[model samples]
Target: MNKELWEKAVAFHGHACPGLALGVRLCEFVQQELGVGVSPDEELVCIAETDSCPVDAVQAILGCTMGKGNLLCSRAGKTAYNFYDRGTGTSIRVVARRNTAELSREERRRQILESPLEDLFSTTEVKYPLPETARIFKTVTCAVCGEGVAEHMARLQDGGIVCPHCFRAYDR
Candidate 1:
């Protein structure tokens, strides 16, 4: 069995690994480890090792965290996909905090190719932005279905409104 592969299959705290990061059993473990005790029936997510240490400082250096989500397409034919840790196998979603968006998707990915994985997240953390906090210009209603405006459903693209569901694109 690949030790590296196994480590990829566990979950760990988003930032500053908890005292009990004994292999990620569930995404909720972050809460449980802190004595929050999660319900076993709750869905769990897999957390891939985000560290790129030389098989030594993987735990101590791993940074940056993201959860699974569908791909989003822009009117400009741009495709934006959310990053997630596939190892955990959980359905939990982690939001991306705008404050921590230090690099463009292309830049961050380019970084992943040039440097050790840990460096990619050196300044970033598991800080995911909750969808609830993400708001559109005037309302949270889907431009197409007029349903609950979700972060994934609504995105700001060059001063325009984009509804990911029906792919609604319009300028303000």
Candidate 2:
């Protein structure tokens, strides 16, 4: 673990929270496992299982960002991440151990920062296919909600585009 890198991650993420520390360590682990440094482009893709403080750390330390189309989020509600090496087609999934869940938020933060990386996370090699449309999408207007949405995300209904929210309303 690089103290300077952790400090930089903390500065970028605003506060020294547990999520941020986990992200910093996860990024470090990914770099070590892949034998590469922070990525500048789509060479690395990160699929975060939740939208949390740690995502900011991932953006800063791993160079994976939503704008760059390399950072993806899922509503799994778990503090896990899957890092894929586009060049080598190698991937790894990392999940925080359940032991940390029993601690208070402050204690969790302290443990994440001070404990060894092996104590905080469980990692495994995984096979995941990268989606072809992950990086490309067209912007379109949702007729039902009058909101703008990605063309790929907008559903076609009655000859017009509808956002997912409006489409769900119709479904119910």
Which candidate tops lDDT?
A: 2
Which portions of model 1 show Cα errors greater than 4 Å?
1-63, 67-139, 150-162, 168-172
- Model 2, 42-136: lDDT tens digits are 78888888899888888998898888888888758988888888889788888877672688888987787778877877887543456343556
The residue-by-residue lDDT of candidate 1 on 1-172, one tens digit each, is 2234234433332321211122222222233222322222212222232222111112222222222112211222211112233334323322211224587655643443344322222222332322221123445655446666555447755565556765645558
- Listing every candidate in turn, what is its Cα RMSD in Å to the true structure after a full C-alpha superposition? 14.4, 2.7
Q: Please, what is the whole-model Cα lDDT of each candidate in the order they appear?
A: 0.30, 0.80
The prediction achieving the highest TM-score against the true structure is 2
Model 2: residue 92 alpha-carbon error in angstroms: 0.9
Q: How many backbone overlaps does candidate 1 show?
A: 11
Model 1 whole-model lDDT (C-alpha atoms): 0.30
